[model samples]
Target: MATRQLLLRRAAAAAAAPRGRRGYGSTAEYLHRSIVPTMHYQRSLPRLPIPKLEDTIRRYLNAQKPLLNDDQFRKTEELAHRFEKGIGRQLHEQLVAQDNQNKHTSYITGPWFEMYLKAREPVVLNFNAFMSFHPDPKSEYNDQLIRATNMTVSAIRFMKTFRAGYLEPEVFHLNPKKSDTELFKKLIRFVPSSLSWFGAYMVNAYPLDMSQYFRLFNSTRLPKLNGDELYTDEKAKHLLVLRNGNFYVFDVIDRDGNMLKPSEIQAHLKYILSDNSPVPAFPLGYLSSENRDTWALLRKNLLDNGNEEALQKVDSAIFCLSLDDFPVKNLVHLSHTMLHGDGANRWYDKSFNLIITKDGTAGINFEHSWGDGVAVLRFLNEVFKDSIGEPAVSPLSQPASVDSSRAVQKLDFTLNDALKAGITKAKQNFDTTVETLTVDMIQFQKGGKDLLKQKKVSPDAVAQLAFQMAFLRQYNQTVATYESCSTAAFKHGRTEAIRPASIHTKKCSEAFVKEPSKHSTEELQKMIVECSKYHGCLTKEAAMGQGFDRHLFGLRYLALSKAEDLPATKRASSNRGGDLCQSKAKLLKRAGTPA
Candidate 1:
C-alpha cells in the first residue's frame, strides 16, 4: 500500500495536479499502472522476425488494448459537446457467400452510445495517440475511397467497422488505373457518425528486442469477437450495435479459427479477473479535449485485458502507455530532446516522441499522430526549400517492382537498447568525421526572402510561418527566403507522381523538383508564400487529407527538383550522411570529419 502511495505521489508531481478531481473516480485521476515509456529494452525477441507491416501493426495494437484509441487528439472549436452555437459538420456491402438478396448486419457492442449520451460536457477531449495520418495529412493522391495508399483515415475507419481492436490489416486489391476523380473519392468514404473513438494511443514502431516484455500477448488470453458486422447511417455516426459472435476478436489473421475459448475455465482465475475489473468502466482519467491537464489523470485504472495492445494476439496485448504519457522513462527526456528539440537541436534529431510543444500556439493541442518526428522533419525540409526560391517539392525515387516493395519495406524497428547502442556508437564514430564551414545566418535569410513573396496569404501562411519561425527567427540562422508573414499549412494534391503508382523523389527530380536557387532572399520568400497558398495543413479537412506517404513515395522513387540538391553538396564534400537519420548526426559531428 505504501509502495502504491509512493508511485501515485510521484505521478502527481509528473505533471501539474488538476484543479477538480483527486481520487479514484476523479475527472483527472491517475491509473494504477505505470506508463510504459516509449523506450524499448530490445534484448528480448532477438530471434523474432522483424515484423512485416501487418505483423508490426498488430503487434503494436495488441500491446495497446482496444486499439481504435489511437494517437488522435481533437481541439474542438468549442469546449461544449454540441458546439454551443452549432456550425458546420458533417458505406457497405460484400455478398461473398450467403444471403445474396438481403444481407443482414449484426453487432455486439457495449453501451457506448448510452455512455456518450451520459457525457457531461463543458467539453471532453478525446485524445487518441495511436491514430496515424496514414496516406498523409494530404490524401488527394490516393483513390478517394482509400483503395490506393494505406493512409491514416481508413485505418480509423477499419477500427469503427469492427471495434474489435481493429487494425490496418493488409488488404490487397488490384490497383486499376482510373482518371475519373469522382470515382476515386468513392472508394475512401467512412461514416464518421457511425464510429466513436474510445481513447488514444500515440503509436511508435516498437523495436525488435524490447518486444519480449510483451511476448505473452503472442497467442494469449484474447476473446474472440468472430466476424461481427457494424451498421451505420449517412452521416457516419454510430447508431447501434449487433452481434454475430462467430469470430474471436483477438485471434490472429489466419489463426482466428485455430482455437476456441477454453472449456475448462479455472474458477480461481475467473474470480481474480472479475475482482480486478469493474463493469461499466469508463476510459479512466477525464480530459477536456486537448488540455494539458489530461496528463494529470493518466496513471489510474489501467486494465491489461491480458494481451499485447498491438493486436499480435487476442486478449493479450501488453499494455505499455495507459494515459496521455509516452510509456518510456528517462528517455522521454531524451525523446523530448529528439522530438521537440527547438533551434539547431531540432534540425538534427528525430524520434517518434509524444511530448507536445506549441504549434506556434500556447500549449498542447496536437495528437502525436498528426505529425511525429519524421513527418515534422519532412515538413520542415519542404518548408525550408520553399522559403528559398526553390520549388516546394521532394524528389521522387525510382519505382520498385511490386514484390520488392514488400521485400525491402521499411521497418519501424523498436527503439530498444540495441538500436540505441547502435546510435550511440554511430554518433561517436560520426563525431570524428564532418567538417563545418560557417555561413552568415541573416544574410542567408535575406537572400532567401528576396526569392519568395509572390502569392495569396489566405490561410496556410500560418503553418509555413510556424515552420519558417524555426529557421528565420528561431534558428537565427539564415535562409534565402523572406516573406512578410509565414505561410500557413494546407493539404495539397498528392499528385506528385505523374503516375499514381510510381515513387517520386521530393527534390531534384521531375515529379516535384526543387526550385532553382535565386539570387536574392526576397524572391525566395515570394515563392514560399506562393507555395503556402498551395500546401500546409491549416484546416481539419486539409490536415486529415495528407499523410507521410508522399514523403515515402519520394524516398522510394529517388527523384528531386534542383533547388533541394543538398545531396550534390554532400557528394561534393564526399559526405555520407544526407539521409534523415544520418544527416543530423553528420551535422553534429561536422567539426571532426576529415576533409
Candidate 2:
C-alpha cells in the first residue's frame, strides 16, 4: 500500500520534475486485472485538461528563444507578455469555462478536427502518415496464390480474436491514474471515436470526400458497368481484388462467417489470372492517385452522374486486397509496391489494403486516420505469428478441400466517353507523381534501442539528436526539428509535437560537430545524456496534455474568440496578434513523426 502511494506521488511530480533524475519507482504495482468488456472504461475516462495560460506562455517563450534571433525573440517575448496580461487572461477564463462545459471531449478536439479535415488541403493517407508490411520471403519467391490464401485465413482468425472480446487492453508505460493528471492505464477502453479500432472500417482516399473501401467479408464483385452504374450481388461472399489497374471480386468467406479452405482460395485466384477479357480499359481507381483538389473535382463529377451506387460498392467494404503486377524478391521493393503501389494499381483509400505480388509477396497499405500504430501493429504481429510462426500447413502444401460452388465475379463500370478520357488523364497524372518520389531504405545491423539502454539514454531523444547532429556535420548548422509523442495515455488522445531540437541539444551537437577534439568521450556522453533526459521530460509532460504546442493552440483560439467581440480597430490589432501566433506555431511543426 505504501509503495503504491509512493508511485502515485512520483507520477504526479513527473510533468514539471527536474531532468536527469532516476530511481523514481517501479511500474509493477500499477498493474491490475482489467474488467470485462474492454471498451467499457471509455465514458468514465477523465477529460484531457487545459494547461494554465501563464505556464504555456513561459514554455512557448523559452522554446522560441533557441530558434529565434535576438530581435525576433524579444519582439515575440513582449507580445506574449502583453497577450497574457491583456486579452490572453480573458481568453484563458473563457477556455476554462469551455473546458468546464465540455466535460467529455478534449479541449483541443474541435480545433484539431478543423485542422485535420478542412484546414489540410491534400488527403492525409498518402501525404501525412501510412504503413507498409515487409514482404513474406517464401511467398515472394514461390507460389503467390497459396500464400495469399494462407494470409487471408490468418487475417480472418486475427479478426475473430477482436470479435471474441478476448483481446487485452493496452497499458500505458506511465501510471497516470495514480497521478494528479487523470489518465487511464488500460488504453483499449479509452480510445477516442476517431481512433476506435472495432467493427467495419473504411478509408476515403479521394481528397474530395469520395468514400471508397472494398469490404473483405460477405460481399462479391459485381459484373458489368452499365452507363456509370455499378451493382454488387450482396449474397456472394467475395473480396475485391485490384491488380495491374484492374478490379476482380473473389470469394474468401461464406455467409455463416466460415473461412474458405486455402485450396478453394487458390483456385479462385487461378481463375482470375486465366481471364483475359477484362481489359484494363478504364483505370477508375487511378482517379484517387491525382492531387487532392483534382480527385475532389473528378469525384464530384462522377457523383453528379449516376455513380453513387457504384462508389458505395467500393466504399463500404471491410478492406481491399491488391494483387500487384510486380514480382520483385527484394523486401523494400515489395514493401513499396504494397504501400504506394504503381499509383494506378491501388484505390489508395481503404482503411486496410492488403497487397499480394505475382511472386507471392504480401504486405498491407494502411490508412493512418483510423488508429495509431499500437493497435495496427499488434494486429499485424498476431497475423504474422499465426501464418508464419506456426502455420497449419506449409504454404507449399496443397489444401485437401476446394469449394467450387462459387465463381469469381468481375466488376464492370458503365462510363461515358468523357469519363473514359478522365480515367486516361488520371493514369497519366499518377505516373508523373510516382516518378518524382525517391525511396531509400537503410538497414543498421550494429545496435538499436538496446544501445540506448546501455547508455541509459532515451532512444527517441537520442535518435532525434542523431539527426540534428548529422545535419550539423553535413550542413554545419541546426534546423528546427519536431518529434511526435503519443498522447494515447489520455482519453481520446492523438499526438503532441516534442521539439527535440532544443537549446541543450543544439549546444551538444555544435560542440561535437565544430570541435570534435575538444570534448572527451565522457564529456560528450554526459552532454548527450542530459539532452535525452530533457527530451524524456518533455514527452511525459506532453502526454499529460501540458505541452507547449496545444497550449499555444488554446491561447491562439482564445485570442480569436476575443477578437470577435472587439471593435474594428481592436479586432484588426487582435487579428495581427493571432496571425503572429499562427506563424510562430508553424515553426513548432517539424520533421520527426515516427512511421
Which 10 consecutive positions of candidate 1 have the poorest summed lDDT? 238-247
- Stretches of candidate 1 above 4 Å error? 1-456, 476-595
TM-score of each: 0.21, 0.75
Tens-digit lDDT track of model 2 for 40-101: 33444445667787877787776676677798778778877876776667767887898789
Residue 118 displacement in candidate 1 (angstroms): 47
Q: Give me the runs in candidate 2 sitting further than 4 Å from their true place.
A: 1-35, 124-128, 134-143, 172-238, 251-253, 261-263, 273-279, 329-335, 390-393, 396-406, 554-595
Model 1 Cα displacement at 317 (Å)? 5.4
Q: What tens digits encode model 1's per-residue C-alpha lDDT throughout 177-276?
A: 4311234323322212111110010011111111111111111211112211111112221101001101011111113321111111111111222232
Worst 10 residues of 2 by lDDT: 202-211
Clashes of each: 180, 11
C-alpha RMSD of each candidate structure in angstroms: 27.6, 9.9
